[model samples]
Target: MNIVVDAFWDDEAKVWVASARDGIGIATEAGTMEQLQQKLSIIVPDLLAEDYQGPFEIELIARSHQTVAAA
Candidate 1:
């Protein structure tokens, strides 16, 4: 199984926050990008293993911002 992670620093709180779109949250104040990535690497698999089952499919629908705004 493969998953994508998005990580960034939270300036106000002074911590690294990481999350997978599939719903894993890894937050820490360890103070380095590598540390945050390592932590997330460990946590995401366990989180997905607990929540996900079997193969799944996703669809992406693209539309102009103006079209969405008009609706």
Candidate 2:
């Protein structure tokens, strides 16, 4: 099965963190982007193998500058 993974840098921890918003919403952290990707490769499969009956949809919102000011 195909899954989408999002990775971002966490300034507080000074590391890269990744999350799979679909399925089980699995998340992991690593010292670098490459490391985070590698960790996700291992994590995603293990998460899928779990007895989770998940087909969840996650909604992500990104606000424009104007929208941010209004909120």
For each candidate in turn, the TM-score is: 0.50, 0.61
Q: RMSD for each model, in Å, please?
A: 9.9, 7.3
By TM-score, the best candidate is 2
Q: How many clashes would you count in candidate 2? A: 0
Full-model lDDT, candidate 2: 0.60
Locate the minimum summed-lDDT window of 10 residues in model 1.
Answer: 58-67
Best by lDDT: 2
Screening candidate 1 with a backbone cut-off below 3 angstroms (N, C-alpha, C), the clashing residue pairs are none
Clashing pairs in 2: none
The Cα RMSD of model 2 versus the native structure comes to 7.3
Q: Over the stretch 12-69, how does candidate 2's per-residue lDDT look in tens digits? A: 7877666665556787778876676667666666677666445533332212122245
- Cα-based lDDT for every prediction: 0.51, 0.60
TM-score of 2: 0.61
Question: What is the lDDT, from 0 to 100, of the residue 35 in candidate 2?
Answer: 72
